[model samples]
Target chain A: MDKLKAIIESLLFASDAPLTIDKIKSILETEDRKTINNLLVSLTNEYDSQKRGFFLSEVAGGYQLRTRPEHRHWTRKIRLMKPARLSRPALETLAIIAYKQPVLRSDIEHLRGVDSGGTLHTLLARGIIRVLGRKDLPGRPVVYGTSKRFLELFDLRDLNSLPTLKDLQDLGQEWPNDSK
Target chain B: MKEQLKNKSESPYEVQLGETFEGPMDLLLHLVKKNEVDIYDIPVAMIMEQYMEYLKLMRIMNIDVAGNFLVMAATLAQIKSRMLLPVDEEQEEDEEDPRMELVRPLEEYLQIKYAAEDLAVRNRLDWDVFTRNVSEDTEACEKQDQEFVNISLFELIDAFQKIVKRVSSKHFMDITVDTISVNARISEVADLLEQHDSVSFQELLEGQDTKGQLIVTFLAILEMAKSQIIRIMQHVESGIIRIFNG
Candidate 1:
């Protein structure tokens, strides 16, 4: 049992990103998939019950050990060397630009319900987003898309890795209803 | 004094007739200021002559003036010459001020210049604040990196998906019940390697699919690796993985 636990820890630690049960099973000498799955469950429970600084999360279809949100500030400071605080407007603009990328300033304004020409310029200057191309319209307005730096900051491999709209909507429900 | 005036008239300025100023409006404005003339009542002939002189100097310096400058020069000269002609009552109706068209564009340019200066001042202030924030942010980032692993599981799935996509595109006979499962074959290979110190990876992969089989065998190698029953070694950029007993 101790050997199994040690093996699991080593495997998870050495893994470049994450590991799944099937992967552990295939790697282990044992032919029992159920045993590996049980082991993973038990490990996950132990980690969570202990309230460790790190937690095992099943994300992107694999299990990975990551720092808890409560420790994010300190951990980010220690690891990444800086925590840039984006303004509320900048964050909102970024979110819109990220999800609706290859979008135009006009489209962003329509969604934001505000004139975002200045915000777009700010984002462009910051290298957070860039002009993808000009639209085939009367004015030939430029279209914008998130830059590679966006993926680096978000820790995403590519745009395809973003959670689906349905997942976001479901997550949104977790917040308390503020209608008063 | 009349001869001196004639000599000045024959100078390079007059010699370069119809040559247009690079910045005709600026030159015209400058002339108006120097002569203390009203902008509304610009001395067209004097300004045109001065403008042509400037263009002549620019040409002598080998500077290629743009067509727009030349066009404006022509327009000014035409307006100046037209102003000299005595107009009858009927022809007076045909006359129009060319300077009237320039008024709006010039006013718009001035407004834009002022706005740009204001924006620059604001930007400088914002940049000072931003730099201070950046230093503080860097400290926070350093703390995060030290305490957090910051791993994303998505990267693993992406890697797996790539391998799957590569394997799927190639032609291979599907492993059926009658045929040995890759998992079982891997176990057998692991057991064999447990007794032998080393085995040829290519020899193990023999009798397998030309393309897809390599990946399957590689997967088997990884499986054996997980058990610590076998080990594989390879040089940088070498696709071959040498199998050995653990």
Candidate 2:
């Protein structure tokens, strides 16, 4: 178990990007993904227990080592990077895509009553949203939807965890209406 | 504040918009909320006139009112015209409300706007939970041109695809491959490169055209490139790749 943990650690350390469970398993020539899954958890726990300068985290759909947030000030002093800067328009476009996924671009333009060509391009370039396919309408307009990276970016467990209209309303902690 | 500013201007056409980022829907939603009107039951004529009046101010302030705003204005006018006339009793039973066309989109837009605001908050919170970034993107100056040291595996595959596409048309019959290894093809590519100082990507797959052969050749090319046995360089942007002996 100790040797296995060390091997996984070195594998992660050598990797420049996050390694998914399948990736780790393939490299280690392991069969059961669950065994490796446990080892990853144990490694994270061990890191947390030791209060290490860096910790393994599941980001962008894979495991990668990242510095502790407390130590980010030092990194920031060196270089301040705000990757994926979502402007106001981009965020609005993203929100619409999230709520009504598989939505047509024409429908988005109609809803916003504005040209979304640039905003859509920005979101695509950032890899937050992608063209799911063309809608089965006239001209077969492109449909947009949030990507898996969107889920990871928002730190959401899944799409179902997205805040619905009711979620927004009940954010004030209101009781469900019984009289209506 | 806009009202006070409008009064001082002594011009009915003058209007002050709060910020540059407000979209047409954002403005309409703002009006809907301020009026506390039910989204399902928007007063179209009243809202349309108010919307037009706001546009007057937007125009006075030299704010670029996109055609979408005017389209909505036209839509509102059409809805208003529809509302002015009484519907027949039979038609009213199965008829859709004139205001529904505008109301539905507004409700959806407002919902998403709120959600986006919520997401912005969550995104800030997400930043607190940092992850390891091995890219070292910010280690140097932020605005420096990218150092294209190592190309992505996908980029290499794309280049290989272009080469295979050129060859596939020539050999159309061979699809089934009983035996062909990527490692074997790697040596083949190396030997081919040894014969020439530099080879265009197409020359490497001179004879191989089948899907199986194309794939194997692609794998071999990628393997050699990774092992530093060959250098894949494009003489120009979006041009043919040249494989150089490493």
Pick the TM-score winner. Answer: 2
Encode model 1's per-residue lDDT on A118-174: one tens digit a residue: 667766776668899998999898999988645434444456776644455444432
Q: Name the runs in model 1 displaced over 4 angstroms.
A: A1-5, A16-38, A72-80, A97-105, A113-180, B1-246
Clashing pairs in 2: A65-B132, A66-B132
Real interface contacts reproduced by model 2, as a fraction? 0.34
- What does DockQ give for each predicted structure? 0.06, 0.14
TM-score of each: 0.29, 0.58
**Candidate 2, residue B31: CA error in Å?**
1.0
Residue B119 lDDT (model 2): 73
Residue lDDT tens for model 2, B14-100:
112222134577667655765778778888777887788777744533344667677778888999999888998888988889888
Give RMSD to native, each candidate.
Answer: 30.2, 23.0
